[model samples]
Target: PRLLKAIEQRMEQAQLRYEISGQPARVFSEFLYSTLKTWSRPRRVIAKAEHIGKANPRFVVTSLPQFDVDWKDDVTVLDAKHLYEKVYCARGEMENRIKEQQLDLFADRTSTHWLKSNQLRLWLASMGYVLLNEVRRIGLKGTKLAGAYCGTIREKLLKIGARISISASRSRYRPRIRGRSCSVWSGSGSEFLKHRPISLTPLI
Candidate 1:
């Protein structure tokens, strides 16, 4: 409520559209310096306000000083809006990656009695997510699921019904399709299977 009131008061004044989110919502940011009783001096705070059909406000506090320092000829000093959008937004993306690992890859399944076992499980899940992400970037590029999340890719691509026939010589896989969906499996599905590591057989 306090944050909302602060954002609403700022929204009353003229604000500039600085950055756009994936939802295409225009965000406006402002810097505020405030000092609390626990702090030694005033700290810098960034407030980002967005209005789509409704008001969405967010805030971030940082110790980074505001200066006109330039990193390179092409790179200039970060303003309040630039710092909020670039630095904070990149942090938000990292949070999304963590969520994908935890949710999609079951990284949070730490019910084991041994702490080391649970740590190993979490590490395995994180490694699986990294490998699958690399597959999405390299193999699934230019496809329909190029931008799809890990869960969607797992459900649609990996979790499919198929029949396997194994013999002493080799193994064969036949996908079970309902109707016209077989065409999808015949084209991109076959290509995906060919590229992916379907079996543990060593290549000589």
Candidate 2:
């Protein structure tokens, strides 16, 4: 009941401020509170009070000592906003990396009955993901696929289906590509893998 009342009052104030300034208003505050049954020991609770189109109040309970101090000035609000944005929102990026591994590299394929085989499969998948990630980070620098996921790189480069015909004098690697015509990279067979043109025009 106390928390609800506090949130409602903050929303009312935020709404008034929004109407006056014609912009969204927010309030950041922290207080020490305790549960009636579970955690009687009081803990610090941070609240983000805001009114965009409606009431939008967010709360986070933390054990950080920096937030323990009373926040009354602009410097304290800045610090709290930075801490909340950095410490809490960074989990989203971490989750993105995990999703990339699972979806792109098949990291969740652990249905085998044997534990050893499942472990080996997961290990190999992780290693493969790391290797490709490094290739994007180092080898594919300044390329279109540098910031691309593993699955995209595989589709664009590795999965190219080219019909090769070689003669004694020279070799020609002709790959039938979709869309309009592309500039043929005519070079020795050995130079094919060694050098990639700056253009990321798909090889099909």
Candidate 3:
């Protein structure tokens, strides 16, 4: 309840959209409502989320919510690497646990149960990704872009401009350059840019 309340307060200030799952607040609170119940150790609520991602035909999962809220129009989908680590990889572990021990808390014999389980997993993965990114953004402080949105983290932020051009079945992106193509001296060097664009865009 405290965590949910805190998240709600912060969301108001940050204008964030969120929703809660796992179990209802009332259900959780019921266990702690009485002094005797409080004295007893609470049973662990073991809900697991597995990311079906591209393997499934549904939307991508990224984060968990504390309250049901509408999503803002401006939110961008997180990067693929972050999605893999935060969703697919984590879900893989849960799948292993279920198959190995048949100890999944949410698994059911019905197809709807399986579908819900998969969807929940994706949502939780997305939530974890968002939370982790927020921490990174806060820790980095005054550096380039404060948030990690699925691409290389810029060391020294650069200023550039861009224009989008499109044609039938084809689209071209043109970016105005303010500097020369220079070697990046930070971590991974060329390896980071191997899969990502080399052009650095500052979040000023």
Candidate 4:
């Protein structure tokens, strides 16, 4: 009840309100000092009340002093909104990237009984994700799959159905793409493949 009342009071007296970029919500932020029963001293707290259709309030307690402290020449002073939106929100984005790696690149797969082997597996998965990200950055530029997820790219491009013929001199890949998929490949696929040593022979 106390927390709710505090949030409501802050919302009522909100003086700093701004719209976050690329988000439909309005955020109001304020700084206050409060202490929990288990704490020895009052700490600086940042209260952020977000409103889209309904009120959504959040609080963050930090050991960092109030924003009024004098800064050195090279130091940067962080305000409440900057701390919450820039620092905290960026941390959340980093967590999303970690989740993407775990989901798309099988980073969470550690079935090996040995600890060293599991560590090596995780390292390999991380390396694979790095390489895939590089490919997306360089090769998939200006394409529909440029901003696509790793799993989507894997399913659409990497796991494409193809007939492979191997001879003593060379190997040939006849892609089994059709309709829009074929069109997409025909447009930019050759440009993408040009960096590699493989040859793309036109099918008669």
The candidate maximizing TM-score is 4
Candidate 1: tens digits of C-alpha lDDT, residues 1-204: 655666775554323332333242544555565555666766677887765545567788887766555666454556678788888889999999899989999999999899999999988998899878976776576677778789987877778899999999999998777653454435554556667565777878
Comparison by lDDT, 3 against 4, better one:
4
* Model 3 poorest 10 in a row by lDDT: 24-33
After the best TM-score superposition of candidate 4, give how far the Cα of residue 88 lies from its true spot, in angstroms.
0.6
Sort all candidates by TM-score, best to worst. Answer: 4, 1, 2, 3
Model 4 Cα displacement at 176 (Å)? 3.1
Error of 2 at 166 (Å): 5.2
How would you encode candidate 4's per-residue C-alpha lDDT over 36-113 as one tens digit per residue?
A: 677776667777866544567788777764444445545556777888888778998899879878999999999989
lDDT by candidate, in order shown: 0.71, 0.72, 0.38, 0.72
Model 2 ranges with Cα > 4 A deviation: 1-29, 33-42, 47-58, 67-79, 139-146, 166-204
- For candidate 4, the per-residue lDDT at 28 reads 45
Q: Estimate each model's TM-score.
A: 0.64, 0.52, 0.19, 0.66
Cα error, candidate 1, residue 152 (Å): 1.6
What is the alpha-carbon lDDT of model 2 when measured against the actual structure?
0.72
Q: Which ten residues in a row have the lowest lDDT in candidate 4?
A: 15-24
lDDT of model 3 at residue 7?
A: 33
